[model samples]
Target: MDSGQEALTLLLLAPLFFICMVIEYRILKKRGYSDYSLKEVVCNFSLAGLHQAADLIATLLLMPFFLWLYQFRLLDFSLTPVTLIVLFILQDFFYYWFHRASHHIHWLWASHIAHHSSEKMNFTTAFRQSLTYPLSGMWLFWTPLMVIGFPPSAVVLIVALNLGFQFFVHTRIVKKLGWLENIFNTPSHHRVHHARNPEYIDKNFAGVLIIWDKWFGTFVEEKPSLVIDYGIPKQVNSWNPFVTTFHQWRTMLTLALSTKPTPFHIRLRYLFGSPKFADNAEKRGTTIK
Candidate 1:
């Protein structure tokens, strides 16, 4: 995972995204879903850039920790192609559970909700990541890779590649790929995941493969003619990323503390409950089809 290798890996994967985008745009045009205004596209691009910058800064700040892990033999630096592929698959496997937990665990959802806040499903939405994740123990999810002999650098690269693959799946341009859609996490699947519709909420948590969701009972097929309304039901419409990320968290903390005789279970649920739990539990249940 030297700089040259890292750069090359990104370069190689970059074209995949471009190709996917082209395919998506063409499909959207054919389906008459290509009604995006220039202004909206520009806004989405700007937000994506801002998020990328945040991720860059976060990665730099976390570099020392990764380096330290490598220096102490907490991580091994193997670079064979097979090992790298295995690491990539393993990372996505862990990512699946981490993502699933973020939906079920209240505290983690506070940090993860930003990525789901967009009403429009596109590649830009895929870049809309939360800056609060590092503070929320996301790095711990990858520790098993290190413990099992994957190098920290390799793990980081594989993780990045995994994420890069997902960017293409956020768009509405590409529809179902028939069998491919069933076996993989496509835009169709992810759109359902992002939907606030009762049947769509909390489904399709895979990062790369759809098998994880199917095996775990979280899979849901896209229902044709049923439109997806994105964003949390209680929308956090603020453009301020910080507000969007922490507002729910703050409210949840207050609720947890204010509730008298709060059992550990209630506190836990407060952290991970559906976004509308405080307003209407029955509604939240109904919202989740």
Candidate 2:
């Protein structure tokens, strides 16, 4: 499916999405654990709208760039049943690195924090994407697929599929999936990914599969003993979607262009290095929580 087809698919799934949200709310409320306020749900939808708008602007650059790269395709691979399967794996692999980098690298995190800004996790939270992602160089992560001869159409369609699979894993309503949790990116694994706890930080970066997290040292299984605290360490406690979207951008600029006779290298580090590096440049490792 192309972008248009993907849009149609998501549109068709809207009712199901609403139903899932309602069911999750009802169940969680029954269990006396659901804390989702009406205003919070509205915030989720608003942020999602903001993300979709920015995503459209992003495709203006991404679609053309991928197509241009496809012209120099090194090898022509037909989209057989086998090739699509291989491309899906490749796409997931690349998405892993992109997702991981977005956490470790400050510049990338500026665009990614929006998705994690919400303290609550639900299907709607998956829609809370950053407006800055396109400019944050996320599109460049997939360039390797184009250079390696994967058709642009297949590359984009596979990416959409990966994203579609990820939406359901955002909920706290579902816990472990028994055997499936061992292979796929289930809600349990993703809960760890979204966690603000020291042990859970930056773990489980897989887009569709959990195997990549296992291959990478980044994988951390959810600990039933410890309660998961969702949201980033630096919280954005605003209901305004624009405020949530631009919070990091403002923070980045302020940190990068500080009035303190900050050296060029330090400023550069704030713009490109680890999120914590900007403060106390020599500081290393996780600051004790």
Q: How much lDDT does each candidate structure score?
A: 0.73, 0.81
lDDT of model number 2 = 0.81
**Residue pair clashes in candidate 2:** none
Error of 1 at 207 (Å): 0.6
lDDT of 2 by residue, 1-48 (tens): 154544555667788888888888888889997667777778878877
Across 1-289, the per-residue lDDT of candidate 1 in tens digits comes to 3423333555577677667656766777778875444554554555555555555666667667766665555445568888888888889899999999888776788778878877778665775676677667687798788777787667777777787778878876667898898678988998889999998989999999998999999999999989889888777766665666677677667766653565676666666675456436333432211
Off by over 4 Å in 1: 1-77, 257-269, 272-289
Can you give the TM-score per candidate against the true fold?
Answer: 0.78, 0.92
Candidate 2 weakest ten by summed lDDT: 280-289
